[model samples]
Target: MTDTTDPRHAHREEGFPAQQQDQPGLTDETRPDPDHGESTYRGHGRLQGRRALITGGDSGIGRAVAIAYAREGADVAIVHLPEEQKDADDTLALVRAEGRTALSLAGDVRDEDFATRVVTETRSALGGLDILVLNAAYQHDIDGFESLSTERMRRVFDTNLIGMLFTARAAFPHLEPGASMIVTASVQAYQPSPGLIDYAMTKAAQVAFVKALAEEAGPRGVRVNAVAPGPIWTPLIPATGWDAERLATFGEDTPLGRAGQPSELAGAYVYLASDDASYTSGAVLPVTGGKHL
Candidate 1:
């Protein structure tokens, strides 16, 4: 009998070392670099000849999806902040390793012009766009909801919602029948966390975005969906300004008793982006390690 890896121990199950980084953390700065499925994923042309654009694709969950998409035969274009140049290069290299076209676009998604430009750039560079992954986001723990300043709140809202809207709006006109748009939502949307209340608001809004857009795009043959993840270990986690103790025990409360790695999310994204999920749309597929959505 083929030995199937136990889900409970599929990836790192231990607590993380206490650490932190400035916002938009780089992969190298992360204590244990996230797994982007470099050596493990094997694709069978699920996305052959497809073109995709992933925001925040320099590292973390975005990078994982980029790797999986490339292996599945999709040419990829990744949008990221200029500070993530190093990580972007690394992701580009991995995609090119699969002989897929890789384009690195550096810009802040918070800028509406840039967000719109990325879709244009991806379409131009990749010849056409078939997939758009709205995965860019920002989150900082709030000590007290009363102290949530307008500036910080705006940053979270702009990055998580406005930026996503800008990109999606720009891509809609270009999207043809059969194209797909996937949002990277969070479990916090359903089960709100006091510390991440603002972030949760945006994620919940994303669910509405997916559902409402699905209705509008369905007739056009385009699909809109979301993937709500649990406590996945990514650069975003270290950069969330959590206390060392909190960082160490992150995601341990989950049913799996461990944090998820970026690699683990690759399959969910690949399925949603591929023809395998042809009939799936307006759905929020949860990758939360058994966490109830």
Candidate 2:
């Protein structure tokens, strides 16, 4: 007999309950807390003995990936804003539960110094680095392009793009052959939204960064790739300043008729980081819910 489950109704298919949180949202505050695959993921030594540094790993997709990486046998270090220490602690504890070394570095990725330093810190703590998940990001909705403040635009670019560059540049020398760098790009790169104009712009730039860097990193036996996720239920969603109605129907427009869960994206990261993808580089694997990238 074969097991069958409907994809549309698999995890969460109904609209989300209206909720909101401040920037750099907390996992505890998100209603109907997002799943990080704690109970479902079963690893088979896919990433054994690897050391990874994941930015924005305090919560959301970053946290999910951290948990998955740890379970897959990777010592993990996560970077987050000092304000997110509580969330970071929870994620670290989860990593530790897997009996793997876990490090949490609290600092704003927007700071060039901090961004670069965290890479060194992770390497020192983990002994070496083999996987770099450049997943830190920030986004906010705009009422209109005219109303988008220069401050907000700068913050978006700094956190999402500059931070990525700082950490990647710092990791290059430490990355040996077979090292993998995975950027958390987004479906927004392909489909832009007016309210998230600045955020979308940064995401699009990330895709370009992945492609260009892959050309440079590939010849060194290092793989550079990206996972472009569609509408997923993460703290970033509620905190993006969406109206209640918009929040309720957040991902209903997807062909899947539902938003994705962070857990659903783990396999893509794992596959890209593992030798299974030895021949894969300069690729943008879309985890979008039936959305084309």
TM-scores, all candidates, are 0.99, 0.98
CA lDDT of every candidate: 0.94, 0.92
The 10-residue segment of model 2 with minimum total lDDT is 1-10
List ranges where model 1 is wrong by over 4 Å: none
Q: How accurate is candidate 1 locally (lDDT)?
A: 0.94
Residue pairs of candidate 2 with colliding backbone atoms? none
- Report the C-alpha lDDT of model 2 over 1-293, residue by residue, as the tens digit: 77997778878888888888899888898988899898898887899999999999989899889999999999999999998999999999999999999999999888999999998899899999999999998899899889999998999999999989999999998899999999999999999999999999999999999999999998899999999999989988888888889978978999999999999999999999999999999999998889988
| Tens digits of lDDT, candidate 1, 210-275 | 999999999999999999999998998989999989988988989988889999999999999998
Residue 238 shift from truth in candidate 2, angstroms: 0.7
Model 1 TM-score, 2 decimals: 0.99
Query: How close is each model in CA RMSD to the real structure?
Result: 0.8, 0.8
> After aligning candidate 1 to the native by TM-score, how far in Å is the CA of 114 from where it should be?
0.7
How far out, in Å, is residue 165 in model 2?
0.5
